[model samples]
Target: MACLVIHGGAGTIPRASLTPEGHQAARDGLRDALRAGWAVLGQGGLALDAVQAAVVALENHPSFNAGHGAVLNAAGEHELDAAIMDGRDRRAGAVASARYIRNPVLAARRVMEASDCVLVSATGADEFAREQGLDMVEQSYFTTPLRQQHWQRAHEEKAGLLKRERTEAEKHGTVGAVALDDLGNLAAATSTGGYTYKRVGRVGDAPVIGAGTYAANDVVAVSCTGLGELFIRRGTAQDIAARILYRGDDLSSAAAAAIADLTADGAGAGLIAVDAAGAMAMPHNTEGMYRGSVTADGVLSVGIYSDDFAAVETIG
Candidate 1:
Protein backbone atom coordinates (compact mmCIF):
# COMPACT_ATOMS: atom_id res chain seq x y z
CA MET A 1 0.00 0.00 0.00
CA ALA A 2 2.89 2.38 -0.45
CA CYS A 3 1.77 5.74 -1.81
CA LEU A 4 3.06 9.22 -2.66
CA VAL A 5 1.43 12.66 -2.96
CA ILE A 6 2.70 16.04 -4.17
CA HIS A 7 1.61 19.67 -4.63
CA GLY A 8 3.10 22.32 -6.91
CA GLY A 9 1.46 25.18 -4.97
CA ALA A 10 -1.91 26.53 -3.89
CA GLY A 11 -3.63 29.88 -4.49
CA THR A 12 -6.48 31.65 -6.32
CA ILE A 13 -5.28 30.64 -9.78
CA PRO A 14 -7.61 32.57 -12.05
CA ARG A 15 -8.83 30.41 -14.92
CA ALA A 16 -8.72 33.27 -17.35
CA SER A 17 -5.05 33.87 -16.59
CA LEU A 18 -4.14 30.30 -17.52
CA THR A 19 -3.88 29.45 -21.18
CA PRO A 20 -4.51 25.90 -22.31
CA GLU A 21 -0.84 25.35 -23.04
CA GLY A 22 0.06 26.60 -19.58
CA HIS A 23 -2.50 24.27 -18.00
CA GLN A 24 -1.12 21.26 -19.82
CA ALA A 25 2.42 22.18 -18.87
CA ALA A 26 1.54 22.30 -15.18
CA ARG A 27 -0.18 18.92 -15.33
CA ASP A 28 2.74 17.35 -17.17
CA GLY A 29 5.10 18.71 -14.55
CA LEU A 30 3.01 17.13 -11.82
CA ARG A 31 3.00 13.82 -13.65
CA ASP A 32 6.79 13.86 -14.01
CA ALA A 33 7.21 14.58 -10.32
CA LEU A 34 4.91 11.72 -9.37
CA ARG A 35 6.76 9.33 -11.62
CA ALA A 36 10.10 10.41 -10.22
CA GLY A 37 9.03 9.54 -6.69
CA TRP A 38 7.09 6.46 -7.71
CA ALA A 39 10.16 5.02 -9.38
CA VAL A 40 11.97 5.10 -6.06
CA LEU A 41 9.10 3.74 -3.95
CA GLY A 42 8.31 1.02 -6.45
CA GLN A 43 11.89 -0.14 -6.27
CA GLY A 44 11.92 -0.40 -2.47
CA GLY A 45 13.63 2.92 -1.79
CA LEU A 46 13.39 4.84 1.44
CA ALA A 47 10.48 7.20 1.92
CA LEU A 48 12.94 10.04 2.48
CA ASP A 49 14.67 9.36 -0.85
CA ALA A 50 11.36 9.13 -2.65
CA VAL A 51 10.16 12.53 -1.40
CA GLN A 52 13.47 14.22 -2.14
CA ALA A 53 13.46 12.79 -5.64
CA ALA A 54 9.92 14.04 -6.21
CA VAL A 55 10.67 17.57 -5.06
CA VAL A 56 13.87 17.66 -7.09
CA ALA A 57 11.85 16.97 -10.21
CA LEU A 58 9.54 19.86 -9.30
CA GLU A 59 12.47 22.15 -8.63
CA ASN A 60 13.85 21.32 -12.03
CA HIS A 61 10.52 21.96 -13.74
CA PRO A 62 10.33 25.51 -15.03
CA SER A 63 6.56 25.81 -14.48
CA PHE A 64 6.78 25.79 -10.66
CA ASN A 65 8.50 28.21 -8.28
CA ALA A 66 11.28 26.34 -6.54
CA GLY A 67 14.56 26.15 -8.41
CA HIS A 68 14.85 27.26 -12.00
CA GLY A 69 11.74 29.46 -12.07
CA ALA A 70 12.01 31.01 -8.60
CA VAL A 71 10.68 34.51 -8.18
CA LEU A 72 12.90 37.41 -7.28
CA ASN A 73 12.95 39.14 -3.91
CA ALA A 74 12.65 42.88 -3.27
CA ALA A 75 16.39 43.02 -3.89
CA GLY A 76 15.84 41.21 -7.22
CA GLU A 77 17.70 38.14 -5.99
CA HIS A 78 16.80 34.53 -5.30
CA GLU A 79 16.76 33.23 -1.76
CA LEU A 80 15.65 29.63 -1.78
CA ASP A 81 14.48 27.54 1.18
CA ALA A 82 13.95 23.80 1.61
CA ALA A 83 13.40 21.13 4.26
CA ILE A 84 13.23 17.33 4.56
CA MET A 85 12.11 15.08 7.41
CA ASP A 86 12.28 11.37 8.02
CA GLY A 87 9.54 9.82 10.11
CA ARG A 88 11.72 6.89 11.11
CA ASP A 89 13.37 8.95 13.85
CA ARG A 90 12.10 12.43 13.09
CA ARG A 91 15.51 13.52 11.85
CA ALA A 92 15.27 16.67 9.76
CA GLY A 93 17.37 19.27 7.94
CA ALA A 94 16.69 22.68 6.41
CA VAL A 95 18.43 25.49 4.53
CA ALA A 96 17.33 29.13 4.26
CA SER A 97 18.37 32.03 2.05
CA ALA A 98 20.59 29.79 0.05
CA ARG A 99 21.93 31.73 -2.91
CA TYR A 100 24.03 29.25 -4.86
CA ILE A 101 22.94 25.69 -4.25
CA ARG A 102 21.29 24.29 -7.36
CA ASN A 103 19.01 21.95 -5.44
CA PRO A 104 18.26 23.27 -1.97
CA VAL A 105 16.52 20.04 -1.07
CA LEU A 106 19.69 18.03 -1.69
CA ALA A 107 21.58 20.43 0.54
CA ALA A 108 18.93 19.89 3.20
CA ARG A 109 19.38 16.15 2.93
CA ARG A 110 23.10 16.59 3.40
CA VAL A 111 22.47 18.67 6.50
CA MET A 112 20.34 15.89 7.95
CA GLU A 113 22.68 13.05 7.10
CA ALA A 114 26.17 14.53 7.31
CA SER A 115 26.00 17.50 9.65
CA ASP A 116 24.94 17.90 13.24
CA CYS A 117 22.83 20.96 12.54
CA VAL A 118 19.16 20.80 11.67
CA LEU A 119 19.12 24.23 10.01
CA VAL A 120 21.67 26.39 8.19
CA SER A 121 21.15 29.80 6.69
CA ALA A 122 22.42 32.42 4.24
CA THR A 123 26.02 32.30 3.10
CA GLY A 124 26.75 29.64 5.67
CA ALA A 125 24.19 27.34 4.10
CA ASP A 126 25.62 27.98 0.66
CA GLU A 127 29.12 27.31 1.94
CA PHE A 128 27.99 24.12 3.62
CA ALA A 129 26.41 22.92 0.39
CA ARG A 130 29.62 23.68 -1.44
CA GLU A 131 31.66 21.83 1.13
CA GLN A 132 29.34 18.86 0.78
CA GLY A 133 29.92 18.88 -2.99
CA LEU A 134 26.30 19.56 -3.90
CA ASP A 135 25.60 21.19 -7.24
CA MET A 136 25.97 24.98 -7.14
CA VAL A 137 24.72 27.62 -9.54
CA GLU A 138 24.91 31.36 -10.04
CA GLN A 139 22.01 33.41 -8.67
CA SER A 140 21.05 34.12 -12.25
CA TYR A 141 20.38 30.44 -12.77
CA PHE A 142 17.12 30.82 -10.88
CA THR A 143 15.82 33.81 -12.83
CA THR A 144 13.39 33.32 -15.68
CA PRO A 145 12.09 35.99 -18.01
CA LEU A 146 8.60 35.58 -16.61
CA ARG A 147 9.84 35.99 -13.07
CA GLN A 148 11.76 39.07 -14.08
CA GLN A 149 8.61 40.56 -15.53
CA HIS A 150 6.71 39.74 -12.38
CA TRP A 151 9.37 41.42 -10.29
CA GLN A 152 9.32 44.44 -12.51
CA ARG A 153 5.57 44.65 -12.27
CA ALA A 154 5.75 44.38 -8.50
CA HIS A 155 8.09 47.34 -8.35
CA GLU A 156 5.97 49.28 -10.80
CA GLU A 157 2.82 48.72 -8.79
CA LYS A 158 4.58 49.76 -5.62
CA ALA A 159 5.79 52.95 -7.31
CA GLY A 160 2.26 53.72 -8.60
CA LEU A 161 3.34 53.26 -12.18
CA LEU A 162 0.72 50.51 -12.52
CA LYS A 163 -2.81 50.83 -11.25
CA ARG A 164 -3.72 47.13 -11.20
CA GLU A 165 -2.73 45.01 -8.26
CA ARG A 166 -1.03 41.68 -8.81
CA THR A 167 -3.33 38.74 -8.77
CA GLU A 168 -3.24 36.19 -5.90
CA ALA A 169 -1.44 33.77 -8.21
CA GLU A 170 1.66 35.94 -8.22
CA LYS A 171 1.85 36.12 -4.46
CA HIS A 172 3.16 32.69 -3.48
CA GLY A 173 4.35 29.30 -4.72
CA THR A 174 6.10 26.15 -3.41
CA VAL A 175 6.79 22.47 -4.20
CA GLY A 176 6.34 19.65 -1.76
CA ALA A 177 5.96 15.88 -1.44
CA VAL A 178 4.97 13.28 1.15
CA ALA A 179 5.17 9.53 0.97
CA LEU A 180 4.49 6.28 2.84
CA ASP A 181 7.06 3.73 1.74
CA ASP A 182 6.68 -0.02 1.64
CA LEU A 183 8.52 -0.26 4.96
CA GLY A 184 5.83 1.86 6.58
CA ASN A 185 8.29 4.72 7.01
CA LEU A 186 6.94 8.13 6.10
CA ALA A 187 8.73 11.29 4.90
CA ALA A 188 8.06 14.83 3.73
CA ALA A 189 9.95 17.53 1.82
CA THR A 190 9.21 21.15 0.79
CA SER A 191 11.03 23.76 -1.26
CA THR A 192 10.29 27.30 -2.41
CA GLY A 193 11.62 30.58 -3.72
CA GLY A 194 9.63 32.57 -1.18
CA TYR A 195 6.86 34.95 -2.26
CA THR A 196 7.47 37.38 -5.09
CA TYR A 197 9.12 40.66 -4.12
CA LYS A 198 9.54 39.55 -0.52
CA ARG A 199 12.03 41.47 1.55
CA VAL A 200 15.57 40.20 1.41
CA GLY A 201 16.26 37.46 3.98
CA ARG A 202 12.57 36.85 4.43
CA VAL A 203 12.44 33.13 5.14
CA GLY A 204 9.11 31.36 4.66
CA ASP A 205 7.50 28.30 6.27
CA ALA A 206 8.84 26.01 3.53
CA PRO A 207 11.98 25.43 5.59
CA VAL A 208 10.32 25.46 8.98
CA ILE A 209 9.99 21.91 10.26
CA GLY A 210 6.67 21.84 12.05
CA ALA A 211 5.00 24.56 10.07
CA GLY A 212 5.48 23.45 6.47
CA THR A 213 6.93 19.95 6.79
CA TYR A 214 6.44 17.13 9.26
CA ALA A 215 6.66 13.34 9.38
CA ALA A 216 6.01 10.68 12.00
CA ASN A 217 6.10 6.95 11.42
CA ASP A 218 2.88 5.20 12.32
CA VAL A 219 1.15 8.58 12.12
CA VAL A 220 1.35 11.05 9.22
CA ALA A 221 3.73 12.85 6.91
CA VAL A 222 2.84 16.34 5.66
CA SER A 223 4.14 19.10 3.36
CA CYS A 224 2.44 22.49 3.00
CA THR A 225 2.39 25.37 0.52
CA GLY A 226 0.69 28.78 0.82
CA LEU A 227 0.98 31.95 2.84
CA GLY A 228 4.10 31.25 4.87
CA GLU A 229 3.16 33.46 7.76
CA LEU A 230 -0.21 31.80 8.29
CA PHE A 231 1.31 28.34 8.06
CA ILE A 232 3.97 29.34 10.57
CA ARG A 233 1.50 30.81 13.04
CA ARG A 234 -0.76 27.82 12.76
CA GLY A 235 2.01 25.19 12.86
CA THR A 236 -0.02 23.79 10.01
CA ALA A 237 1.77 20.51 9.36
CA GLN A 238 2.21 19.49 13.00
CA ASP A 239 -1.35 20.49 13.81
CA ILE A 240 -2.62 17.84 11.42
CA ALA A 241 -0.50 15.14 13.01
CA ALA A 242 -1.59 16.28 16.45
CA ARG A 243 -5.21 16.09 15.46
CA ILE A 244 -4.80 12.55 14.26
CA LEU A 245 -2.76 11.57 17.28
CA TYR A 246 -4.70 13.15 20.12
CA ARG A 247 -8.19 13.67 18.74
CA GLY A 248 -8.32 10.34 16.88
CA ASP A 249 -9.04 12.12 13.64
CA ASP A 250 -8.40 10.27 10.42
CA LEU A 251 -5.85 11.56 7.92
CA SER A 252 -8.47 13.23 5.72
CA SER A 253 -10.38 14.72 8.64
CA ALA A 254 -7.29 16.03 10.35
CA ALA A 255 -5.91 17.60 7.18
CA ALA A 256 -9.31 19.10 6.36
CA ALA A 257 -9.62 20.58 9.81
CA ALA A 258 -6.25 22.22 9.52
CA ILE A 259 -7.09 23.74 6.13
CA ALA A 260 -10.53 24.70 7.40
CA ASP A 261 -8.94 26.68 10.20
CA LEU A 262 -6.71 28.48 7.70
CA THR A 263 -9.68 29.17 5.41
CA ALA A 264 -11.59 30.65 8.32
CA ASP A 265 -8.71 33.09 8.71
CA GLY A 266 -8.94 33.96 4.99
CA ALA A 267 -5.74 32.20 4.09
CA GLY A 268 -5.19 30.75 0.61
CA ALA A 269 -3.13 27.60 0.86
CA GLY A 270 -3.08 23.84 0.74
CA LEU A 271 -1.21 20.70 1.81
CA ILE A 272 -0.43 17.05 0.91
CA ALA A 273 -0.24 14.28 3.48
CA VAL A 274 0.16 10.50 3.72
CA ASP A 275 -0.36 8.11 6.60
CA ALA A 276 1.54 4.96 7.55
CA ALA A 277 -1.24 2.91 6.05
CA GLY A 278 -0.55 4.52 2.65
CA ALA A 279 -3.67 6.69 2.87
CA MET A 280 -3.21 10.08 1.19
CA ALA A 281 -4.98 13.43 1.44
CA MET A 282 -4.69 16.71 -0.47
CA PRO A 283 -6.79 19.60 0.72
CA HIS A 284 -6.67 23.27 -0.11
CA ASN A 285 -8.80 26.36 0.46
CA THR A 286 -7.80 28.06 -2.76
CA GLU A 287 -9.53 27.82 -6.15
CA GLY A 288 -6.90 25.38 -7.37
CA MET A 289 -3.74 23.53 -6.46
CA TYR A 290 -1.40 21.52 -8.71
CA ARG A 291 -1.52 18.12 -7.10
CA GLY A 292 -1.06 14.43 -7.93
CA SER A 293 -0.70 11.00 -6.36
CA VAL A 294 0.53 7.47 -7.16
CA THR A 295 -0.12 4.12 -5.56
CA ALA A 296 2.05 1.04 -5.16
CA ASP A 297 0.26 -0.52 -8.08
CA GLY A 298 1.45 2.36 -10.31
CA VAL A 299 -1.89 4.13 -10.82
CA LEU A 300 -1.51 7.92 -11.14
CA SER A 301 -3.86 10.84 -10.54
CA VAL A 302 -3.27 14.53 -11.24
CA GLY A 303 -5.35 17.64 -10.71
CA ILE A 304 -5.31 21.41 -10.92
CA TYR A 305 -8.81 22.82 -10.55
CA SER A 306 -11.31 21.57 -7.97
CA ASP A 307 -13.07 19.30 -10.45
CA ASP A 308 -10.17 18.58 -12.79
CA PHE A 309 -8.86 15.46 -11.12
CA ALA A 310 -8.22 12.48 -13.43
CA ALA A 311 -6.83 9.03 -12.76
CA VAL A 312 -4.69 7.53 -15.46
CA GLU A 313 -3.85 3.95 -16.24
CA THR A 314 -1.11 2.25 -14.24
CA ILE A 315 2.21 3.89 -14.91
CA GLY A 316 5.03 1.85 -16.35
Candidate 2:
Protein backbone atom coordinates (compact mmCIF):
# COMPACT_ATOMS: atom_id res chain seq x y z
CA MET A 1 0.00 0.00 0.00
CA ALA A 2 1.21 3.47 -0.89
CA CYS A 3 -0.60 6.64 0.12
CA LEU A 4 0.33 10.33 0.08
CA VAL A 5 -1.34 13.58 1.10
CA ILE A 6 -0.63 17.34 0.77
CA HIS A 7 -2.07 20.65 1.95
CA GLY A 8 -1.60 24.26 0.69
CA GLY A 9 -2.99 25.72 3.94
CA ALA A 10 -6.14 26.06 5.94
CA GLY A 11 -7.92 29.36 6.68
CA THR A 12 -10.88 31.60 6.01
CA ILE A 13 -9.98 32.32 2.41
CA PRO A 14 -12.98 33.30 0.33
CA ARG A 15 -13.37 31.47 -2.99
CA ALA A 16 -14.10 34.76 -4.69
CA SER A 17 -10.69 36.06 -3.68
CA LEU A 18 -8.84 33.47 -5.79
CA THR A 19 -8.63 34.07 -9.51
CA PRO A 20 -8.95 31.06 -11.80
CA GLU A 21 -5.24 31.18 -12.44
CA GLY A 22 -4.50 31.23 -8.71
CA HIS A 23 -6.65 28.17 -8.14
CA GLN A 24 -5.00 26.34 -11.03
CA ALA A 25 -1.58 27.16 -9.70
CA ALA A 26 -2.41 25.74 -6.30
CA ARG A 27 -3.90 22.62 -7.84
CA ASP A 28 -0.83 22.16 -10.00
CA GLY A 29 1.41 22.47 -6.98
CA LEU A 30 -0.58 19.85 -5.10
CA ARG A 31 -0.45 17.51 -8.08
CA ASP A 32 3.27 17.96 -8.31
CA ALA A 33 3.77 17.12 -4.66
CA LEU A 34 1.48 14.12 -4.85
CA ARG A 35 3.23 12.83 -7.95
CA ALA A 36 6.60 13.28 -6.31
CA GLY A 37 5.53 11.16 -3.37
CA TRP A 38 3.87 8.64 -5.63
CA ALA A 39 7.00 8.25 -7.66
CA VAL A 40 8.99 7.39 -4.56
CA LEU A 41 6.33 5.02 -3.25
CA GLY A 42 6.08 3.41 -6.65
CA GLN A 43 9.72 2.46 -6.30
CA GLY A 44 9.25 0.96 -2.78
CA GLY A 45 10.90 3.85 -0.98
CA LEU A 46 10.41 4.52 2.71
CA ALA A 47 7.56 6.70 3.89
CA LEU A 48 9.99 9.34 5.18
CA ASP A 49 11.64 9.71 1.80
CA ALA A 50 8.30 9.97 0.06
CA VAL A 51 7.13 12.69 2.43
CA GLN A 52 10.38 14.62 2.16
CA ALA A 53 10.22 14.54 -1.62
CA ALA A 54 6.61 15.70 -1.60
CA VAL A 55 7.24 18.64 0.71
CA VAL A 56 10.40 19.61 -1.16
CA ALA A 57 8.26 20.00 -4.26
CA LEU A 58 5.98 22.40 -2.38
CA GLU A 59 8.95 24.22 -0.85
CA ASN A 60 10.25 24.96 -4.32
CA HIS A 61 6.96 26.24 -5.64
CA PRO A 62 6.48 30.02 -5.81
CA SER A 63 2.77 29.89 -5.05
CA PHE A 64 3.02 28.45 -1.53
CA ASN A 65 4.42 29.89 1.71
CA ALA A 66 7.27 27.51 2.53
CA GLY A 67 10.59 27.94 0.81
CA HIS A 68 11.21 30.43 -1.99
CA GLY A 69 8.09 32.58 -1.84
CA ALA A 70 7.80 32.54 1.94
CA VAL A 71 6.28 35.42 3.86
CA LEU A 72 8.59 38.19 5.07
CA ASN A 73 9.23 39.03 8.70
CA ALA A 74 8.98 42.38 10.46
CA ALA A 75 12.50 43.23 9.31
CA GLY A 76 11.60 42.32 5.71
CA GLU A 77 13.58 39.08 5.69
CA HIS A 78 12.43 35.52 5.09
CA GLU A 79 12.68 33.15 8.05
CA LEU A 80 12.05 29.50 7.24
CA ASP A 81 10.86 26.72 9.54
CA ALA A 82 10.31 22.97 8.97
CA ALA A 83 10.18 19.54 10.64
CA ILE A 84 10.30 15.86 9.66
CA MET A 85 9.50 12.68 11.55
CA ASP A 86 10.03 8.95 11.02
CA GLY A 87 7.49 6.96 13.00
CA ARG A 88 9.24 3.63 12.70
CA ASP A 89 12.20 5.03 14.60
CA ARG A 90 10.34 7.59 16.73
CA ARG A 91 12.97 10.16 15.76
CA ALA A 92 12.43 13.69 14.44
CA GLY A 93 14.26 16.93 13.70
CA ALA A 94 13.16 20.54 13.36
CA VAL A 95 14.50 24.03 12.64
CA ALA A 96 12.86 27.32 13.47
CA SER A 97 13.59 30.96 12.61
CA ALA A 98 16.22 29.86 10.13
CA ARG A 99 17.44 32.21 7.38
CA TYR A 100 19.60 31.52 4.30
CA ILE A 101 19.11 27.75 4.38
CA ARG A 102 17.61 26.95 0.97
CA ASN A 103 15.78 23.83 2.15
CA PRO A 104 14.84 23.91 5.80
CA VAL A 105 13.19 20.51 5.82
CA LEU A 106 16.32 18.82 4.47
CA ALA A 107 18.29 20.65 7.13
CA ALA A 108 15.94 19.32 9.75
CA ARG A 109 16.41 15.81 8.34
CA ARG A 110 20.16 16.20 8.60
CA VAL A 111 19.80 17.29 12.19
CA MET A 112 17.77 14.18 12.86
CA GLU A 113 20.28 11.91 11.17
CA ALA A 114 23.53 13.51 12.37
CA SER A 115 22.80 14.84 15.84
CA ASP A 116 21.28 13.52 19.04
CA CYS A 117 19.30 16.70 19.45
CA VAL A 118 15.61 17.00 18.56
CA LEU A 119 15.55 20.68 17.58
CA VAL A 120 17.90 23.49 16.49
CA SER A 121 17.29 27.19 15.95
CA ALA A 122 18.14 30.06 13.56
CA THR A 123 21.88 30.50 13.29
CA GLY A 124 22.51 26.98 14.50
CA ALA A 125 20.33 25.39 11.81
CA ASP A 126 21.83 27.64 9.16
CA GLU A 127 25.28 26.58 10.32
CA PHE A 128 24.29 22.94 10.03
CA ALA A 129 22.97 23.51 6.51
CA ARG A 130 26.23 25.19 5.62
CA GLU A 131 28.18 22.30 7.09
CA GLN A 132 26.15 19.89 4.98
CA GLY A 133 26.82 22.01 1.84
CA LEU A 134 23.18 22.79 1.18
CA ASP A 135 22.49 25.86 -0.92
CA MET A 136 22.73 29.10 1.02
CA VAL A 137 21.48 32.42 -0.30
CA GLU A 138 21.09 36.02 0.70
CA GLN A 139 17.81 36.89 2.36
CA SER A 140 16.83 38.96 -0.68
CA TYR A 141 16.77 35.81 -2.82
CA PHE A 142 13.62 34.72 -1.01
CA THR A 143 11.56 37.73 -1.91
CA THR A 144 9.20 37.05 -4.83
CA PRO A 145 7.57 39.83 -6.80
CA LEU A 146 4.10 38.63 -5.85
CA ARG A 147 5.05 38.41 -2.19
CA GLN A 148 6.41 41.94 -2.30
CA GLN A 149 3.16 43.19 -3.75
CA HIS A 150 1.24 41.27 -1.13
CA TRP A 151 3.34 42.81 1.60
CA GLN A 152 2.69 46.28 0.25
CA ARG A 153 -1.01 45.57 0.09
CA ALA A 154 -0.92 44.24 3.64
CA HIS A 155 0.74 47.42 4.80
CA GLU A 156 -1.96 49.47 3.11
CA GLU A 157 -4.66 47.33 4.62
CA LYS A 158 -3.08 47.65 8.03
CA ALA A 159 -2.94 51.42 7.77
CA GLY A 160 -6.62 51.60 6.89
CA LEU A 161 -7.88 49.17 9.50
CA LEU A 162 -8.23 50.25 13.12
CA LYS A 163 -7.21 46.83 14.41
CA ARG A 164 -3.54 47.05 15.25
CA GLU A 165 -3.03 43.46 16.36
CA ARG A 166 -4.46 41.63 13.42
CA THR A 167 -2.56 38.38 13.36
CA GLU A 168 -1.22 36.22 10.51
CA ALA A 169 -4.72 34.85 10.23
CA GLU A 170 -5.02 37.54 7.56
CA LYS A 171 -2.26 35.87 5.49
CA HIS A 172 -3.18 32.20 5.52
CA GLY A 173 -1.10 29.70 3.56
CA THR A 174 1.13 26.77 4.55
CA VAL A 175 2.43 23.60 2.83
CA GLY A 176 2.70 20.09 4.30
CA ALA A 177 2.96 16.39 3.32
CA VAL A 178 2.29 12.93 4.80
CA ALA A 179 2.92 9.48 3.40
CA LEU A 180 2.34 5.77 4.08
CA ASP A 181 4.75 3.64 2.17
CA ASP A 182 4.66 0.10 0.84
CA LEU A 183 6.24 -1.31 3.96
CA GLY A 184 3.34 -0.07 6.07
CA ASN A 185 5.32 2.72 7.70
CA LEU A 186 4.18 6.30 8.04
CA ALA A 187 6.07 9.64 7.92
CA ALA A 188 5.09 13.30 7.99
CA ALA A 189 6.64 16.71 7.28
CA THR A 190 5.59 20.36 7.46
CA SER A 191 7.21 23.62 6.32
CA THR A 192 6.25 27.26 6.52
CA GLY A 193 7.54 30.84 6.38
CA GLY A 194 5.33 31.67 9.33
CA TYR A 195 2.80 34.50 9.07
CA THR A 196 3.29 37.81 7.29
CA TYR A 197 4.90 40.43 9.51
CA LYS A 198 5.76 37.69 11.97
CA ARG A 199 7.82 38.85 14.90
CA VAL A 200 11.48 37.97 14.79
CA GLY A 201 12.18 34.44 16.09
CA ARG A 202 8.51 33.58 16.23
CA VAL A 203 8.34 29.76 16.23
CA GLY A 204 5.15 28.25 14.91
CA ASP A 205 3.77 24.73 15.06
CA ALA A 206 5.71 23.83 11.93
CA PRO A 207 8.90 23.16 13.87
CA VAL A 208 7.27 21.09 16.57
CA ILE A 209 7.24 17.47 15.52
CA GLY A 210 4.15 16.31 17.37
CA ALA A 211 2.29 19.53 16.85
CA GLY A 212 2.82 20.38 13.22
CA THR A 213 4.18 16.98 12.19
CA TYR A 214 3.79 13.47 13.58
CA ALA A 215 4.11 9.88 12.44
CA ALA A 216 3.20 6.64 14.16
CA ASN A 217 3.40 3.23 12.60
CA ASP A 218 0.75 2.02 15.02
CA VAL A 219 -1.83 4.57 13.98
CA VAL A 220 -1.25 7.40 11.54
CA ALA A 221 0.94 10.29 10.39
CA VAL A 222 -0.27 13.88 10.36
CA SER A 223 0.78 17.36 9.18
CA CYS A 224 -1.08 20.52 10.12
CA THR A 225 -1.56 24.08 8.81
CA GLY A 226 -3.52 27.00 10.15
CA LEU A 227 -3.27 29.44 13.08
CA GLY A 228 0.08 28.48 14.53
CA GLU A 229 -0.72 29.89 17.94
CA LEU A 230 -3.86 27.84 18.23
CA PHE A 231 -2.11 24.68 17.04
CA ILE A 232 0.64 25.23 19.57
CA ARG A 233 -1.93 25.74 22.28
CA ARG A 234 -3.94 22.64 21.33
CA GLY A 235 -1.19 20.34 20.12
CA THR A 236 -3.29 19.57 17.08
CA ALA A 237 -1.11 16.97 15.36
CA GLN A 238 -0.57 14.77 18.39
CA ASP A 239 -4.17 15.18 19.41
CA ILE A 240 -5.31 13.65 16.18
CA ALA A 241 -3.02 10.66 16.67
CA ALA A 242 -4.17 10.27 20.24
CA ARG A 243 -7.75 10.23 19.14
CA ILE A 244 -7.02 7.46 16.67
CA LEU A 245 -4.98 5.37 19.07
CA TYR A 246 -6.94 5.92 22.25
CA ARG A 247 -10.51 6.26 21.05
CA GLY A 248 -10.37 3.86 18.09
CA ASP A 249 -11.37 6.62 15.68
CA ASP A 250 -10.62 6.17 12.02
CA LEU A 251 -8.12 8.51 10.41
CA SER A 252 -10.78 10.59 8.71
CA SER A 253 -12.87 10.92 11.89
CA ALA A 254 -9.87 11.86 13.96
CA ALA A 255 -8.76 14.55 11.51
CA ALA A 256 -12.27 15.94 11.19
CA ALA A 257 -12.64 16.00 14.94
CA ALA A 258 -9.40 17.84 15.39
CA ILE A 259 -10.39 20.51 12.88
CA ALA A 260 -13.82 20.76 14.47
CA ASP A 261 -12.29 21.25 17.90
CA LEU A 262 -10.13 24.07 16.61
CA THR A 263 -13.06 25.74 14.93
CA ALA A 264 -15.16 25.41 18.06
CA ASP A 265 -12.44 27.26 19.91
CA GLY A 266 -12.38 30.01 17.27
CA ALA A 267 -9.12 28.78 15.83
CA GLY A 268 -9.14 28.16 12.12
CA ALA A 269 -6.92 25.42 10.69
CA GLY A 270 -6.57 22.38 8.43
CA LEU A 271 -4.95 18.95 8.64
CA ILE A 272 -3.78 15.92 6.59
CA ALA A 273 -3.61 12.41 7.99
CA VAL A 274 -2.43 9.11 6.54
CA ASP A 275 -2.90 5.87 8.40
CA ALA A 276 -0.79 2.73 8.31
CA ALA A 277 -3.43 1.18 6.12
CA GLY A 278 -2.93 3.95 3.56
CA ALA A 279 -6.19 5.62 4.46
CA MET A 280 -6.03 9.43 4.29
CA ALA A 281 -8.00 12.46 5.41
CA MET A 282 -7.88 16.25 4.97
CA PRO A 283 -10.27 18.49 6.87
CA HIS A 284 -10.45 22.24 7.39
CA ASN A 285 -12.78 24.78 8.95
CA THR A 286 -12.25 27.48 6.34
CA GLU A 287 -13.78 28.25 2.98
CA GLY A 288 -10.87 26.55 1.22
CA MET A 289 -7.83 24.42 1.93
CA TYR A 290 -5.59 23.06 -0.80
CA ARG A 291 -5.48 19.28 -0.39
CA GLY A 292 -4.95 16.06 -2.35
CA SER A 293 -4.33 12.38 -1.68
CA VAL A 294 -3.63 8.96 -3.23
CA THR A 295 -5.30 6.01 -1.56
CA ALA A 296 -4.04 2.49 -1.06
CA ASP A 297 -6.12 1.46 -4.04
CA GLY A 298 -4.16 3.85 -6.24
CA VAL A 299 -6.93 6.39 -6.63
CA LEU A 300 -5.78 10.01 -6.99
CA SER A 301 -7.82 13.04 -5.97
CA VAL A 302 -7.04 16.75 -5.55
CA GLY A 303 -8.99 19.90 -4.81
CA ILE A 304 -8.70 23.56 -3.71
CA TYR A 305 -12.07 24.67 -2.32
CA SER A 306 -14.11 23.47 0.64
CA ASP A 307 -16.92 22.28 -1.57
CA ASP A 308 -14.63 19.71 -3.13
CA PHE A 309 -14.80 17.77 0.11
CA ALA A 310 -18.24 16.42 -0.73
CA ALA A 311 -16.91 14.83 -3.90
CA VAL A 312 -13.96 13.14 -2.19
CA GLU A 313 -16.02 10.71 -0.17
CA THR A 314 -13.15 8.50 0.94
CA ILE A 315 -11.80 11.31 3.12
CA GLY A 316 -14.92 11.64 5.28
Clashing pairs in 2: none
For residues 1-316, write the lDDT of model 2, one tens digit per residue.
7888888787434576677887778777878887888888878899899889989898888778889888887767888999999989879999898999887889989989998888999899899889888888888767788677656656766678534433333475688899988888889999999887778889899998788889989788999998788888888899998998999999888888888888888876889888877777888877777788877665668887767642232321
User: How high is each candidate's TM-score?
Assistant: 0.97, 0.92
* Model 1: CA > 4 A from native: none
Clashes of each: 0, 0
In candidate 1, the residue pairs with backbone N, CA or C atoms under 3 Å apart (3 or more residues apart, or in different chains) clash, namely: none
Where is model 2 more than 4 Å wrong at Cα? Answer: 161-170, 309-316
User: What does the lDDT come to for candidate 1?
Assistant: 0.92
Candidate 2 local accuracy as lDDT?
Answer: 0.82
Please report the candidate that would top lDDT against the real structure.
Answer: 1
C-alpha RMSD in Å of predicted model 1 compared with the true structure = 1.2
